[model samples]
Target: MVPEAQLRDDGAGLAPASAGWFVLNARDARWFHRPGRGDSVPLTGCDELEAETYFPMLGMSIQVLPPGEPNATYHWETEQEDFLVLAGRALLVVEGQGRQLEQWDFVHCPPETRHAFVGVGDEPCVILAASSRQFQKDGPWGFYCADEIARRYNASAPEDTQDGDVAYGRFPPSRPTRYRDGLLPD
Candidate 1:
């Protein structure tokens, strides 16, 4: 069970109220929605954890992407990242190559490996992502995608894009989704 004080219900979503150790079932995890992106349930182990701080060593999350929706702009990170497909199907674009990913498929992305994913079937694709946050002094960097294939899903970087700042600006602020009652299976 999740403590009442640990979850802040601000109408948009449930966020951690403070920094500390906490436990909640996957179905009970807080889901945050990104307007143009999709929904993600961050498993940071603490509410006070920031994206820049690489304390937990492994940053994890469960993301749900609707068909044609891309998780994020095509980019690679300085740290290694791995992914496991939990449900549905998705198209994985890595290092300029595209691969069909099905349930139970696992993906390992080395450092500085460019990759992105898009839901392909009628149903939403669910993915479990884990990344090594160790030695992340400067975080990750976003890559510009000029490929026409990726552009079809709005996953490509804008023309003359300089960095992630330019790509992220195209999307709206993130909102929250109900993981327990919405996406998770009983």
Candidate 2:
């Protein structure tokens, strides 16, 4: 049966029901804000979707990063992850190597491929990131790594660890936020 779509906003932002199926512009999707790191919108409507109704196989989101800001600590997951640069420029640090990416560049990280991204250039870098979730929790889902290159961008874990709290200890907790005009490049 198709789950009915609904809307919710608990002073955070509007998260339209996405179970079964739902349609909404990215600008109307629920977003989150991390201090220093830019805003992000989980395209799957994860904010309001019930746990039992969550997508069983995949997770997706769009990350907006300001210049010199990194999307996350350098890490690798048990599941494959993929990304597409939608706008602006970004520096991709993968497997201890650095690569410059531009609009439309695509990246596919096989399971356990260490990687992270930092925004570059004058404008905010936008990336569409997606990952598989099935079997992710069957074992350790992720492992943060310590790398000199990632460290240069402040995106490396202080030391190797599988604990998320320890790996992300330096960053502030993210808060739910609403989308605003000009957040995305036209």
Candidate 3:
């Protein structure tokens, strides 16, 4: 017998709680917002969803970044990560260099290649970001870089620490938010 698909509301938003396959509209997806930054829609399950489980092989999310805000601090992982610009414009800082990316631009970062993205242009930038979740013997291999260019965008770690609290100390924890209209381009 197949499991029935259902959406469960954990006081935040409706999220898939079934064991089988399901479909959900982006406009109705669960979202979270970080103060002073922007919002993110986790296509899979995020901690905010109260699923207590993450994708075993790969994790994917849609990042909605407002101008002058960054998706994350400059960092690199032990596994490959890829990103595709879906709308608007963004500035990509990779390996101590900066490049402007427009719609449909794709970026692939091999393991240990430091990179970060800052929303540019006049509107919010949308990005589809994915990363491998396979861990190594030493655990999730990753490091935050203290790049000068990243600092200008407020997207750099303070002292090259692996602790997320140190890297994102200035920002508040993300709060549960519902997907609102006009967050994505038509």
Instruction: Give the candidate number with the greatest TM-score.
Output: 2
Which runs in model 3 stand beyond 4 Å of their true positions? Answer: 1-5, 48-54, 136-138
TM-scores for every predicted model: 0.80, 0.92, 0.91
Residue-level lDDT of model 3, residues 64-170, one tens digit each, is 99999999989999989999999999999999999999999999999999999999999999999997777633566699889999999999999898898999999
Clashing pairs in 3: none
The lDDT of each candidate is: 0.73, 0.86, 0.85
**After superposition, which runs of candidate 1 have C-alpha atoms over 4 Å from their true positions?**
1-21, 45-55, 138-146, 159-162
lDDT of 1 by residue, 159-179 (tens): 535475777777887866566
Q: Order of candidates by TM-score, top first?
A: 2, 3, 1
Q: Write the number of the candidate with greater TM-score, choosing between 2 and 3.
A: 2
| lDDT (Cα) of model 1 | 0.73
Instruction: List, residue by residue over 31-103, the lDDT tens digit for candidate 2.
Output: 8897767889886545324522656578789999999999999999999899999999999999999999999
The candidate with the higher TM-score, 1 or 3, is 3
Best by lDDT: 2
Please report, as a residue range, the 10-residue window in candidate 3 with the lowest summed lDDT: 47-56
Q: What is the TM-score (0 to 1) of candidate 1?
A: 0.80
**lDDT at 133 for candidate 1?**
72
